[model samples]
Target: MAESDAWILTTGLNNGVSKLVGEGISQYRLLRRHPKDVVCIGLTMWGTINEKTRIDLKKASQIGASDEACKRQIRDDVQEDKETLDPHHTHCILFDSGNLNEYLSDSQRSSFVQYVCDDKNSHACKEVFFDNMNFQQRLIEL
Candidate 1:
């Protein structure tokens, strides 16, 4: 595939697979000396527990409040955390969801998949699907 037509989209920055993908992309860029050829995007659920925890800690420290009080304030504040794009990623997209890694609703899943598959720049394609049982097998085969 042409480098400019490539994109690496991940579930989140905090996962093992996502980290590996980031490292792979970084290595690719280094070897090719093409820093902007591909896009690395991290897609994370809004208000996920991990995200909330980080925001809570920051808010608590900033306002000098107890944890319980901070939690209350966070509820009232209701603003989403500022984007902290992973070092390896070039961009990020956040979606609204109740919790972490919850099955995305049909519409949301469709939209996300469409974004990946029909990206304007992509022409030819390659995909690897992995699951708990077959992930190792698939990787070995690849």
Candidate 2:
């Protein structure tokens, strides 16, 4: 299947909004791998609401704030950016993860995690994971 066709497959995932973000980065890189894809997938797992949830997204170069701040920033930025950019041109996908069940299934999240781990998309995940490892390790310490 073509890139566009594969994008359609992600459209049905629980992480659809995030997959779109990652795919946009993939397209931006002209089919080359990008660090954003894995970050986007990881962000999707953090849940969309609750300001604390978005802290993980701060690792993405495209996002400028911690997870909590990112939730509010993304909403405002997307709305403002949308005024000047076409919907399709807006590279970031900003839906609430609190509503993830409305969009993706448990299996879909597993698929996303796998995709991020897959060698083909490991760059994104590695970047995201490194940034979050300190935090994750602290959690383990607890």
Top of the candidates by TM-score: 1
RMSD in Å for all candidates: 9.1, 15.3
Q: How close is candidate 2 to the true structure, as a TM-score?
A: 0.21
| Residue 114, candidate 1: alpha-carbon lDDT | 60
- How many clashes in each candidate? 0, 5
The lDDT of each candidate is 0.53, 0.34
Which segments of candidate 2 are over 4 A away from where they belong?
Answer: 2-53, 66-92, 97-142
Error of 1 at 142 (Å): 30
